[model samples]
Target: MARFNRKGTTKVLFVETIADPGYMPTATELGTAIDYSKALAATDGWSIENQEIETPDLASTFVAKIPGDDSAADSSLTFYEDDVDDDIETNLAKGTEGFLIWCRKGRTAGSKGMDVYPIRVASNSAQVSLDNEAAKILVKCSIIDRPLQNATVPTGP
Candidate 1:
């Protein structure tokens, strides 16, 4: 196995249209997607967890538990504030729906290290610090359905 750092190797894209959220997108489709890797600062909460259902009976001393409904956890992306053209700000506004493509091992073709998530922007808020720091925007995304995980990166146009 190869050990590597995630910094400078992650690529994030926001695609307006994807025929199928559960299927991997083609190279042509990925080329048309909007690339937001440059403005991104941080990411969090793209995970899944199951609810535990406990079963207790009068005759049983130990409580039995089973997995219940699985759900996607809240996810968010932090991007550096951009004023030019207001592209990222406007597109990622509240209630905006799109496909979020995250390439962990970069966007190299034939690499199976990509995940495409169909998400709707739940909220978008600005983060301004009083100290010397760049302004940022936090975008909360709600996963609409099951995402395409561990997919392959297509060739570039």
Candidate 2:
């Protein structure tokens, strides 16, 4: 297998609602999602952690360990402030519930992807910088659940 850089491989889409939250969204549903790939500057967090259970029994000197429930960490998306349209700022308001479809290996057909249906909330407000830097806004997402992970990218119409 050949190694490739992640330069032009990520795609982020924000959708207001999903017909069924139990299953992976269809291609038609993904197509209607608002594409925020261009506006996104950086992404932080979204780590999954497993609860460790330690069993210290008198039978053995070592403690037996087991994994318990899994939890997803909160994530943040930093988007370049678009003063001309203000699209990112308007849509990603606090208390907004939406699904964030993140294509880690590009959204092309047969590629790997992950869909996270998280509620949008404000983490840190946009910072104003006097130095030569692009103004960016951070949008926090509380991941309540994950509908799909490491799924194949479906072909879109």
Best by TM-score, which number? 1
The Cα local distance difference test for each model comes to 0.87, 0.76
Total clashing residue pairs per candidate? 0, 0
Report the C-alpha lDDT of model 1 over 1-104, residue by residue, as the tens digit: 99888878888998888775365888988888888999999899877678889999899899999889988888999999977667767999999998999888
Question: For every model shown, what is its TM-score relative to the native structure?
Answer: 0.88, 0.86
- Runs with alpha carbons beyond 4 Å of true place in candidate 1: 56-61
lDDT of 2 by residue, 82-141 (tens): 778877767888777778887778877778756555555655468678989999888887
Among residues 3 or more apart in sequence or in different chains, the pairs in candidate 1 whose N, CA or C atoms overlap within 3 Å are none
Candidate 2 achieves a global lDDT of 0.76
Candidate 1 backbone overlaps, count: 0
Q: Provide the RMSD of all predictions against the true structure, rounded to 1 decimal.
A: 2.0, 2.0
- TM-score, model 2 to reference: 0.86
What's the distance in Å from true for residue 2, model 2? 2.6
